[model samples]
Target: MTDGASRRLLTTRRSVLCGGLGTVAASAIGMPMGAPAVHAAGRVVKISMQRSSVLFTVLKVRGTLAERLAPLGFEPSWHLFTSVIEPMNAGAVDIHADVADAVPIFTQSAGAPLTFYARERGAPSAEAIIVPADSPIRTVADLRGRTVGVSRGSGSHYVLAAALKRSGLSFADIKPAYLQAPEGAAAFEKGSIDAWSIWDPFLAFAEAKRPVRTVADGTGLTSYHRYYLVNDRFVAEHPEVVSAVYEALSEAGRWVKANPEAAVALLAPVWGDLPPAVVAAANARRSYTVEPVERAQLGEQQDIADVFLEAKLIPRRIDATDVKIFRPSTVKG
Candidate 1:
């Protein structure tokens, strides 16, 4: 059979299977219909977004994805999650945008059926390890034996590891407080942690709200390429929807790059009315261009996986290319 016919057959089989599953779940729950029944025709595509994700936030705020998908007979559902891997593993979302490269590596290592559909160019300076302006921690070396706040398994974790390795230090040299971004921000303000390693908007917000110095950033250390991922089943069942999302995001990325002021204006409300200057600063450090995921572009991911394995952050080593990659034009049907 041709690839297009094969995909259609697979989709049909999946739809029937999902319908049965929905009936079974509803019966078990003593309900007439279940969650999957709500999407009997699979018209709704759930998108999980992180607050700090610039391109996704821009797309969400402007309702561009909905506008793009409407004509394609798809509805876009937006949901917020603290991190990308959580909703994906829980089966709560179909597509998740702006996950850090390290996140997928860890998720893949955990044996989740996740696949990459798109990627952003590296924004090395988009994340940083910062200290209060009046603090005595003057250098990366000074971090040794000090408490450092970082969200464990996050992009910032990889950045901290790389930065420390470049400075001839290791994870064992400092006390790691595995706090979320908001918690880390609070800790940083209270002087409970010596420094906080974090990404943009949070980094930008901190800098704008107080005096902080960049002890080091991802530059010369890690690539900081964010990725968009979807459930493996979603790709097999809805390639066209995936393609539409990719095109919509790519277009939004371009729009943000060309219209910084408008981008800031649209995003400020979602960010709790962050100063336009802060948002602009965060946007400046990011590379908003989106492209297809390719094995050739994943060398940094291998390094990141190795770092996590060495640090015992992940259970095992992972081949970064082992997961599926959805190429946009390859959707024959």
Candidate 2:
């Protein structure tokens, strides 16, 4: 049994960023997103995040998982968030559930020092820059000096950083409003924000339901990916647990891919008036594959860090590899 002290160590150390292993790797093989073991007997695991589609498992499935995992003493805790990263730094949540783009910045950001753990094995999480259908912000370049809303370090934040750079603009080129996804979506609808930098299904939701324009996506920015992360201490003390968590995520990713409409239906109740049209559009693009973080992707992230350094989005440069902790073979089914 991992004592309280040991758990705390995991909280601080094995965190996600160096390719966050699912907001950080959870465990087991072919078991499907951290489904509680058939026999619950071990430790109590707490997963926290905003009730968003991306952080799907922790928010939606962890409770049922707790039941199945009872034999392993696996318990479940679901924490809510308007912003994903806050839970990690405060040490209030075991996993800093968020999009992959946020991973690099979370690890390399000047304020925090951490050992990143796990990440989703898939294409980058979805994102886009949205304007009202009636608005004149037709392209990325047109967004210059306009109020662009996004949750900093979230996928949209990264997308905006790269998109702005690609369009011959800097972060200074737009009016940055740091708001949560839901808030940003509402602000976008009310015309409170000129444009929204956000990821699906929010992007799809806004476009289809709110009549917004999508000027870009993750592929557009190339660095806006989804991720799973854990503190470094968790990785060292509970490698088995981490692997188990990853296995479950792999299954969930597969499930999501296979049943896009089901996934959307599952999410709509939580999204608060989000349009199924948007969810459907977003679902067509999500990928579900569990693999190691690839090099090109890392390069994109590195580029983001460098650009941020030049633009002062972040205070300093950080080597993306400095805090990686992944070992797939160590997973226990």
Candidate 3:
């Protein structure tokens, strides 16, 4: 079916199942009958995501978001995009999940009115600087003057920068080939780039298909924490919906951790029918634990902003914690 038509169908299904509940909820919350329902009755929560986001992939595949949000009165709509920060900055989506921490720094610098609601713990090993198994590049230091492929503004981008610095080198020490993960992988396979810095399941996919060695993972470099964000206006107008989404995602994270095998089975097709083993490997490296966004947790983000500023990647320096953050009272049990 066409994308628009499919979304309409999902909305219809959600309204039919939860319409009455939303009205009751609205009344309970002291909202007038003429006012918008607590569940957002006719509103659809457009979630912006990418295929690489395993938690979102699982939630989308299971189709549980609709049921979970039915009482809250919001219909879930999924929008696939290449980059989370771009679409969010353009006002294309109300919410975005699985965006790397570095992306917000750039988006904020660009004046996008975005705010953090939730974050996943650091999964340093999930991203890495990879090289062909037999390549002469044996260390991050060896990358000097060599071409390294990385997706600009991604978590891996920061990982690469930090890796270089840790090696007593800087971005100017090497030539950077800015490419998306898929293109970077193809380029790496074609021997056009000396190394490909990327995150899973692409990392897992490449490792499964070919022999590659990790020069360095994010271990001592970056936190690799993914953030869940929403437009500033959305949070101001519909804080409950934002809360519901954070709770739903937090629950999904728990489910994935508890049932790794099932998560792999469900995510395999969404991830292009990837081998269950590869999916499992990728999932294993990820924390899959969601938590509320905290200022203390943003130290690395500040560091990322500084790094990008130093490299002139972002237009200006930004205070990572200057943006809004929604902290709901109750954590999901």
Candidate 4:
């Protein structure tokens, strides 16, 4: 989008309270997540969610988070975000439901006061580099000099870069058309771009509805974890609330994995009215196991940071492990 389009969308971002579960608005927001039961009436904890985050979307739609927090002395205010980096930096949101692992590296480079709270396990097959069914591109190397659509600073960004490297190529080999999923889908369909680096359910939607072939997925290139982040100030101010939210999110992940059919039914409408089968296909590629963020798990994060830096995507080098990790009171230090 152009600067004007972004500004307009940002101004029109959707925000809701607990009761407005199924509401869809002009645009979305994304941010990170805790606190205790003090029943502080109007104390609203602002949250941001990306549309692709199915488990978090389900949690929001269930409307049970408000009930869970009311006793802890707070109410819930939810915002749907396309990206949480700007919102978190501007303090527009307290908690970001989930974002691809690569996103935080970019946010960190920009010096956002964010902390990692939780993450979904690696699901390598969740994202991929796709081509038109009859395109001449057969391998990652064939992408050389071709135009590839990708979201800047997204997990798929790293996936494409890594896959290219493994094929003895570099990110500069291709012309990157930095487009968000919706625009990327349109461009791909119109043959304006040679290939697209994207994640599910968008990936699923394309496969189920369009003539595209998966050239490469993250299988050997990336693990594709989705991270939950919170503003550092928010974590310090509401420790108990963070703890409650972590617990609730962890349980939501378990429930989604345990009940696939119900998950599809609940997510289909919110995901732009995609068929239940498409939603199911997308969910199948996700590892919705939410757990506390640990330093050991961030090795890939450092790799991602280094890759983006080497590719000139980020301005400077960063130690991805430098950010704060939010550990609930129940978790050991």
Which is the leading candidate under lDDT?
A: 4
Residues 1-333 of candidate 1 have per-residue lDDT tens digits of: 567766654553343223211111111112111111122233787777665667776766576776777777777666655555555666667887578767887788777787788999889888999999998999999999999999877899999988888899999999999887766777887789999999987888888878999999988888889998988998898888889888888898899999999999887655655678988999999898898888888888899999888888888777886778889863344
- lDDT string for model 2 (1-333, tens) is 247655543442243211111122221111122222233456666665543435344225434345444555565555545555555565555555544655457655744434444455444446677788888889999998899898776666777888888889987788999986666766776788898887765666666655666777667456445566666666667666666666666667777777777777765534443456666676676665554444445666676677667777677777764556565444443
Tell me, what's the RMSD of every candidate? 11.3, 9.2, 9.7, 6.7
Q: Rate the local accuracy (lDDT) of all candidates.
A: 0.77, 0.59, 0.77, 0.79
Alpha carbon lDDT at 242, candidate 3:
81
Ranking by lDDT: 4, 3, 1, 2
Question: Could you tell me the TM-score of candidate 4?
Answer: 0.87
Better of 1 and 2 by TM-score: 1
RMSD of 1: 11.3
Rank the models by TM-score, top first: 4, 3, 1, 2
- Give lDDT tens digits, candidate 3, residues 1-333: 567766654553343213111111111112111111234365687777665666776666676677777777777776655556667778777887578777888788889888889888889999999999999999999999999999888999999988887789999999999886666767877889999899987788878878999999999788889998898888888888888777778889999999989998887655555678988999999998989988877888899988888888897778887878889655643
Worst 10 residues of 3 by lDDT: 20-29
Give candidate 3's error at residue 142 in angstroms.
0.8
Error of 1 at 194 (Å): 0.8
Q: After superposition, how far is residue 248 of candidate 2 from its true place, in Å?
A: 0.6
Clash pairs (backbone) in predicted model 3: 39-72, 39-73
